[model samples]
Target: MANKSVFATMAGKLLPRTDTRNHEGAQAYSLSPRQALAQLAATGTFNATFYAGAREQLTEVLELAWQVEPEFLAKTAVFAFERGYMKDMPALLLAVLSCLHGDEFGRAFPRIVRNGRMLRNFVQVMRSGATGRKSLGTRPKRFVQAWLEQASDVEIMRAAVGNEPSLADVIKMVHPKPTSAARAALYGYLIGKPHDVLALPELVKAFEAFKRDPSLPVPAVPFQMLTALPLTREHWVAIAETAGWQMLRQNLNSFARNGVFEVEGFAERLARRLRNPDEIRRARVFPYQLMVAFTTADAAVPKVVKEALQDAMDVALANVPAIDGRIVVCPDVSGSMSSPVTGHRQSATSKVRCIDVAALVAAAFLRANRTARVLPFEQAVVEIDLNPRDAVMTNAARLAAIGGGGTNCSAPLERLAQEQAKVDLVVFVSDNQSWVDATAHAHQGTATMQAWNKVKLSNPQAKLVCIDIQPTTTTQAKGQADILNVGGFSDQVFEVIATMARAETGADHWVEQIEAITV
Candidate 1:
């Protein structure tokens, strides 16, 4: 017989070496520069996470931006905004692009900075000198000028709500040559400069008129523009009637506090609208966002409204694809996962935590694939039964309320191997900072890779995916033909996971998707 202990299999020798340490100081493999950029673009909010601060994230992103091709950076900005539904990182990437003279930056600018908040973020980042330039420069100035010239009156009006390098500030710095008298007046109005009031656009005129006379019908403006006025029940009712899906969802408590729900039939009507399938689809609503609204709603909010958010979650999770084979999803419920999903900002920290997103992913998988198993893990596999028939939000809440010990990324996989479990796909949703499993004797590769190697012995065709919910440059499992390391909390991730599980892709599937992006 061959010396089985002394002579390892070819696969054993082929296991990639651990090259770096995770935030927890665990053995991990560093991602390639391009891979790191994509991951950061999808997950970095420039806010402080449990491990990295806002400044550190900003510095790392800039470092990676300099390492990749300018074209990749441009495509990434578009991808982050359009698919990932991210705000800050996309704007930052666009700001970085603006410093270069290439057409990629110019092409990506209009697409990424599509609205007021984005425009403000772009200008703020540029002026802060974070992207190697403090000024918009000649070409970027042209883009800014074009944006001001081309935007419609209403579009520009809606853009007037946010500040801190406000649209007004951007206008002053860029000095956009307004193409029409209305636009010129609008610019002056935004910047508080004297202008002919008669030249104001109809929407602006309507807003001004409504401001002057409370009895006048409420103008269809941003919710922020209406808050200062002494609004009556009728005004609040009118605001609810015209508010968009997102605005209504976020301000449910505010509406309740202002007695909008007290109006007979208004609460029921708003509830119906909240759960409307068309509106849910049209809003591109994330299931977790609905979860946030459901969780954060105050006691004053109506019962029907909360239930409607639950229904909206069902409609929002339509993107969770059904996989064809046995699946096991392990959601990390460890201590570090308690940090906010978008990280911690002083006043703007997200209520949704990394654990909530992980649980949501696992619950979504179980809902889509009824037979799929869920193993919520912390220091080890914390066994918990989840019903597929239950609502995604319910199952997610149950899983999210589990253990908060050290992270052991290999625990669930180790359990599967121990039981000789057969799985076609194994998904691990985590922060990818597993320190409990990094033993002194196991220096060749991560404990996750070791456990995965064992699982692969029995099921050679199985695939593994690590869905990272935080911005980090390392992973427990290195990318390979059967392993995928992707990040993001958006439903866009579901499509890639489904494609990979169906064997429609090879290694670098995530990178391939980003590379295939057109400018």
Candidate 2:
């Protein structure tokens, strides 16, 4: 009976010793080059996080991209853009490929740089000289030219929204040979050069006519193009009626401010549009995005519209699997989790933080599986009763309110061990900067690993999923058959969690998922 804890053997493979320090200076395991690249591709926005700066993130991603094979880099770019729905990191990877691997860059270009914003991001990042070369390089220039040439006139007009490297700037740099008189005219118009106005596309003509005479019917152009123009509430009402799902969700406040909501029957129409399952599915709305809309809506925004956002949350959470057996979700509500989820960027910082995302994940699970247990952890487990029937936004708000403490990733698992609880799956949504439970010695894996070992003693089949909401190359728990380390705030993570919880993925699950991408 002497020191059973010291002498006991675990049923699982021995955890790897902590090999590196995380951004929080806690002992952690360094991810492999491929794993690190994929993790960063999924979560890194190259903005300042609580622990790392934008430059540091950019350096790390470039370093990791260099370490991995060109194929893996291509696959990761495809995975990040298509599955993770990430913007900047995927473009960065593709930019890196442009210099070193032309063929892989070509394969990934059309996929990652799929839209206008992404196209601008590619040009901007490539020109930043952060990816080792400043110029677009010959092949990448050809790809850009082809993209400009193939996109429809409306697509090009929509692409004209953002700047830094505007679509016009790209057209100037690439000088894509116009295929038709209309194409040449459109290019000249975007770049502010004189061209035959008669050759312009009909939509462009309509937009120009509407701009000149406000009495005409409002053209269906991007809202940015119309914002500066003097328009009546009637025009805004028309824009609100026709705005796409994402556009509408993002502009509720603008609609309210413009008195578009004052029109009779329009509010009800909008509420229905927001709650439509088909619209939500087609838009690929993330649950947190709905949370943003719900929280950011002004008082003038109609009540029905807010309620419809909640309904949209339920639809977005459709992928959150109702896994069988006991489950525990641990969301780190530490002080650092308060950093902007997308990292901090001046004038562009997200009101949503890492804690909010963790809470959203936990609440979504409880919504999907009524029996699921949620333990919000800071230095230790914060006890709170949550009604599964409550709206996902409500539960998420409650969890996020309990915040500003040290992170101890092991606390919930240790509590589960203390209670001798039998769990089928344990999900940890956090920044993974667990230092409160750090051990003094380097030989030990981590406090989280040690606690997970104890938990596994009673339930060997139990799975663990660590969803890192911030970008980092290390984890408190090393990934194995029973453990998965995935990153990103996109709802796609829920699908990965569901698949992993069912034991459907092999070792290096995250990397394997990236490899499966057909780039």
Candidate 3:
């Protein structure tokens, strides 16, 4: 007679965001995540065709998750399986089920056992769902049993894994970064990294840096940064001895269980003095502290390209004046950057649009007094600052010298993280064509969501801007530009980057950033 339903207790408990668009999502090939889920539920009621590509499915899944509940996920988990939503999920969900209840917990994560009790909550989500009128998949059942009985290292790896290392340790890995300075301070304890972000780039750099030079630069940046306010030395970042950012950090346990990565090293925290980040005050430091640092090293790229990069910087500086704004931009001759900058598909010949734009933006930041570091990635980063003069041949030589081949997607983003507090934002303009994921059987990387997820985890405080100018040229035009994969792919890129940027700064900052790029 009443609504004593399992859905009621945990309707919106796990994930809180909800996608409300219902009509437009169906009319178009794409649906906002929430509509997809709603459609999935509605689709299950009737017989319907859902997309099959893993990347597309993943986008739909994350968008749904961003807005739906575990109850909704559970329903889709059950219903979508029947509808051929994506044939590969049962195995993944089984691993999740096992990881939540498996004994592998104490062994792989000994320190976590004391507080990782959150792992148990996952089972309630699995068992309470409607597996009604259906037989449990065997591999999934067996996996769950194996997990409940004896969770082994091999068992965990079988679930999902890869080697991912990071360069720094202090930055938080949470998404939707809060704007409050007080929250930022309290977040140090709560906003700490999950086992994954540590395995990203910053951890690698920080460790290698320590090995080479044990002394960490005290203030992070080269010189100084203006104090926002209430960021006094006496302030403590650790608040709510229990109720802090760890509220979610504790959930990172789920990551080890379901995500495709590992944390197989001495688990440790980066020790540093933290102040109340929630507050900012004027005159936190002298006016001179705002100046940014810039430099480019490595002689592999064409020297003229470096010159051109500098010339662009000069032009950008001439346009704006900001004290601490700086950029260290390097043009690449290493191979990947020289492909072509034209925004067309068939024109695979050489061109100079991205390099030119990269140089212009890099120089503009530096001229504004912000530090900019630019390099092109192939086997590794070729840090040759493209030297630009008024001469066209010089520009062409630099552009022609630079080459674009191979894939180096993560390197630049990691580079930005290495700069730490020194950089306030990162604007990466590139063509979204990675040999690694773009050619995968089914755009599997997009489905995994790790690469996208990693960006949110590692650079918890920096603004990341991706302007896709994927160009094409047959021969007539030097290069043409088309912004593709703003969401990573066309749809996902728009959703993912915008979400991460807003999370890094505030919604307001994200607005200003878009205006800067478009205006």
Candidate 4:
């Protein structure tokens, strides 16, 4: 009851708009808008308490974010949109554009509007505002035009005459002048809708220009148009040669859905692309991409295809810095972590759970540092043998096997203390739902804090790093000079670790330093 009350109290604090100041119950300073958005996107579940605070001060946060760190805000919005967190999306988008002055919105708008999912949501959100007698501010107009220019015919047609007549009026309000071959192709499609005379000529010119310069970037409009047109095998081959691995990866699902290969020898070519070590090293693949691939790969994908993907991931993993300290990773495998990750769409029978993220983080540390040990815990601690060369998912499965009956967050530290182990860093990957038995130590402090104090006493130099994989409640380990609390699964998490390892002042100092670097 106390634990539940603690969570309720934390949520209660966030309900008030004026109480934005950082406090023990509400660590507002630590919860940046970007970080909060990341947590929401990853978990697919919004904490009403947390989000209520965000919604109340949404414009203020956007204003501050734009003034201090526009790039972070822009990037976070794109990521949040892609991750399907859309509750405050209409306001969030408007706020982002309002805060950015001059051509800032113009430059950032393209990236946000290019996604089909984003475009669909934009139309819906904008239509809802129109229906509710809310104003569609002038700032989103530029983005709407940009989206119209780049959108496929299917999307344009859907927006133009589909259910919402206001959307058609909005689309007709802004006319995009096509400057690029791709945009020209999209323009041609738009004009051709009503049998405009310039349509054929525009399409021909765009195709000819693209055929002459295969190296030029193909925007979505032209790509979709070309797919519909009768293009020769040679043209598709040229497009394939010019398209980068990132593009190929992005379109893989589309290809699977359409049962069409944009390029010949799709599987073999992608496999070869993944095998290139330099390409893998240079690719901007994030940890979440790997997670998605592991979970969503079709059963028909060949063994070699899966192996190639794994090889690419391995190359990326090589970049993780090897820290110079003995690190013990304690991943909480309690029943709480069995819940499905927030936004991941999986079947009812799927076994993939939130704890997989904890395992992956532990594996990442193990792979990065030879001195790292994995101590998975539920009600108690258990050691799992891990090798740097082991596949990450394999390590996750191994860790998940030692499932715990209850959450005892302090068990890892207690085990280390019992063994008199001198660890430099103790990383707890958990939901931070640490609760003592109702009958035991009800009036005392948390078992995690008490165990952490004992560990600190034994090894004064040891620091506790709590990685909140499923942060649903207030963390048991308070943010302090020696304690670092990070949420979500990102490569940035490792960057923080590397920075902490090198810093002489301790966790808080480097935490500030990292925040500066990000900002």
- For candidate 1, give the lDDT of residue 70: 91
Write candidate 3's Cα lDDT for 126-154 as tens digits: 33342221222343334333332343322
> What is the C-alpha lDDT profile of model 1 across 1-519, one tens digit per residue?
888654556453356778888888888999988899889888888888989989998998999998889998988889889888888899888888877767988889888878878888888888888977888898878888888788888778788888888788899999999878988889999999999799999899999999999899899888799999999978989998999999999999889988999999988999999999999888988878988999999999999999999888878877789988899999999999999998887796789999999999999999999999998899988978889999888899999898489999999999999998999999999999999999443355888998999889889899998999899989999998899998887887888898889888765765677788998
User: Which parts of model 2 are misplaced by more than 4 Å?
Assistant: 1-13
**lDDT per residue (tens digit) for residues 1-519 in model 4:** 557744443211122121122212322223444444444333333222211233333334433444445555555555444433333442345345544565545554555555444554555545554223344456666667767766655465444332333344554555566656554544555444443334434435455566567555443332544565545545555555555665554555544444434344776776788667776545566554665565576765555556777777676566567877788889888876775544223233324456777877788778778678889998787756777677776776687666657777788987887887888888888766654321132233445655677777668877887876643324565556677766556565676666665654443432233234321
Error of 4 at 192 (Å): 7.5
Off by over 4 Å in 1: 1-13, 441-443
User: For each candidate, what is the lDDT?
Assistant: 0.88, 0.90, 0.30, 0.56
What's the best-to-worst order under TM-score? 2, 1, 4, 3
Q: Number of clashes in model 3?
A: 89
- What is the RMSD of candidate 4? 8.5
lDDT of 2 at 318: 82
Q: Is candidate 2 or candidate 3 better by TM-score?
A: 2
> What TM-score, to 2 decimals, does candidate 3 have?
0.28
> Model 4: number of clashes?
1
